[model samples]
Target: MTATTLDAVTPAGAAARRPVSGTVHSWDLSTGVDGPGSRFVTFLSGCPLQCLYCQNPDTLRMRNGRRVAADEIVAEAAKYRRFIRAAGGGATISGGEPLLQPVFAGELFHRFKHELGYHTALDTSGYLGARATDALLRDVDLVLLDIKSWDRDTYRKVTGRSLEPTLDFARRLADLGKEVWVRFVLVPGLTDDPANIERVAAFAASLGNVSRVDVLPFHKLGEAKWAALGMDFALRDTPSPTPREVAEAREIFASQGLTAV
Candidate 1:
């Protein structure tokens, strides 16, 4: 993520009750992995990063989504309150990068908390974490932070962006005692290096607020999307890490005392 990822909003403003609007790519009532049990997940549109493995390349453009109002989303989420609450689940504002529509996302999350009385989570890449202010985070019950890599050069190679911004965001979240679920992708011959994984584990361990770590195995699931978008599928030659590799990476996080899932 880059500063441009959050080009749609700035930090430091108090969240308002008005009907703020944003672009949405899609949504689903998902379970298990998003956050907690089951969730009413809203996928916002636009992202600045060009991660070669992006599964939803269709959602990467800022101008390609339908504009939606926060109240509409809140109303939709409210309808699912009974089922979601019973499942120990909540609402998640995910995206190509939700921070891109900061005001809209903040308002939706605030409503989810104060109005619906449900858990609110932000599934983010933390590239735009700098744009998430205290007021916004205040309403967020959890943050599923995807820390792609720990090495600076390796990070740039992986996501085509700098690493400092993400770390800065993670530290800020830590300072606030926010519950964080760290997600790292394990790609063979690229991000599967043990030293790199260890570094990530060490940093997450230092945070003292990370509740869990998810070591996701790399996959070519997005290959067809890349072809459809006329983007080169660079990972055609890059293999997904084997099951053993996934286990080893999880072990590394566990060794650092992180709860690996």
Candidate 2:
């Protein structure tokens, strides 16, 4: 099991340490929070969407995480630069939704880029507004944007939000020449529909600067977290996506001239 720790400090101490202001719900200062390649990742607090498959349900509540300053986060991230450089990886600011805390993320990204010179990435669901998108994109080097589904109805059913904003955000990123890796969770009988996959592939092909497409096979890793939070697990009986299903989705994207990772 993956273990997590929480650190709480006084506002004054936090302020004196970092120039940026905001609350950090939780943070993982370890290597490989997302995958291989040693890197530091900060799990920012708060989110606007209620994705049914989200594993970090505790981060959904805005008030539940500890309050932390931006500089403090930067300071913590700086310590891992050597590891990040050696592994060809850097710091990634993830969330409940990083865009929800634009100011904090912006400040952190600016410091990492200009001050520390560490590569930066944003792992988001891409549901932020135009203004927020512009601010967050200024310093982000790589974007791991999640596109839940191409159909508005399916997106609404899965994430409890509209699909237009996310699509618009993706387009905006492409226009800015930002490197984006579009990700989709391949959920059986939900997002794995061949028709939907074709539509999504077509849409992604329309965007420029999308270097990669990732087809993530859905798993029930977060079900226990949901149960612990006393929240209903919608995909309780949903089996993990099969290898054949994943291969099919990959093939769909490959045929669209996009490299599927």
TM per candidate:
0.93, 0.89
How many residue pairs clash in model 2? 3
Off by over 4 Å in 1: 1-18
Q: What is the lDDT of residue 74 in candidate 2?
A: 79
Q: State the lDDT of candidate 1 residue by residue for 1-261, as single tens digits.
A: 332443354332346433357788778899988999899999998887778677778888866678776778888888999999999999998879888778778878888899999898999999988878788999999999988988888889878898888899999999999999999999888888899999999999999999999999989998998899788888898888889989999999999999997
- Candidate 2 weakest ten by summed lDDT: 1-10
Give a tens-digit lDDT track for model 2, residues 1-261: 011112222222255653556656677755643533666788877777898788788888766677677778878888877877888777788878887767667777777778888778888988874545465577788888899999889999999999998898888888889888888899987888899999999999899787889899899988888989889999998998879889989999999999997
What does the lDDT come to for candidate 2? 0.79
Score residue 111 of candidate 1 by CA lDDT. Answer: 80
